[model samples]
Target: MTERPSLKEMRAKALKNPEVKAEYDALASAFEMKRQMIALRKAAGLTQEEMAEKLGTKRSNISRLESMSASNSPSIATIENYARVLGYSLRVGFEPAAAR
Candidate 1:
């Protein structure tokens, strides 16, 4: 039997490609937002079901909103609502991008 490369190793190799890296960089902000959303929910000690109840939505809806691979992008209002339920206020800001 052959040993398989670890996911971290595979990811590092894949990210070495300029095209793949570019695509990954483009999606970084969305991934970071989803991560922060999940973190906030956990820190607030709320399960998806609890979050759904607070938001007046279904558990599945909460799951989709926190998913990185969700097909539809959530609206700003939806994000604001999510943050509000977690005792947070949504704040969007701009920063200079790294020189390409």
Candidate 2:
């Protein structure tokens, strides 16, 4: 059988592995959440400092929450608190739901 060479090709092969696919899926979801948080903060017309004050946190903390590469993620409870402070509620549901 033929063999594939180079790191890029090996990485591409790894993507076909179930474990690798699952890891990618999880990472994508995490990034999406960070994006959503950033969008929400913008839509509320709140500076990071303003949002931090409303959340009882520091601006840096709010900054970190919007960063996917950050080592720390804000707790779900903290996100819920921020949503509540902005008079919004967090909702999670399956996508492409069928009619009830």
Candidate 3:
């Protein structure tokens, strides 16, 4: 049997398609946000359960907040609360979009 392609290889191939690349680009910010949330939680040494307790929410809710495919986008207040629970203050800013 042949070895399967690695995820990186498969992703590179998939991203070759213009439509798939566009969709991926569209979701890049959301993906980056989720990644940063997970990193912050890890840096705070908090499990999902612990984070939920601090946030007065459920573990599942914390999981959803860190999930890339979460159906509802979290509001600024929600993000602020998450950061506050991790002993951080949230900051939001904007920069000019890069030319495509």
* Number of the top lDDT candidate: 1
What do the candidate models score in CA lDDT, each in turn? 0.95, 0.81, 0.91
The best candidate in terms of TM-score = 1
**TM-scores, in order shown?**
0.93, 0.64, 0.91
Taking the tens digit of each residue's C-alpha lDDT, what string does model 3 give over 1-100? 9999999999999999989998998898889888999999999999999999998999999999999888999999999999888788887778787677
Whole-model lDDT, model 3:
0.91
Off by more than 4 A, model 1: none
lDDT of 1 by residue, 10-89 (tens): 99999999999999998999999999999999999999999999999999999999998889999999999999988889
lDDT tens readout by residue for model 2, 29-94: 678877877887889899999998987889998888778778977677887887787777887666
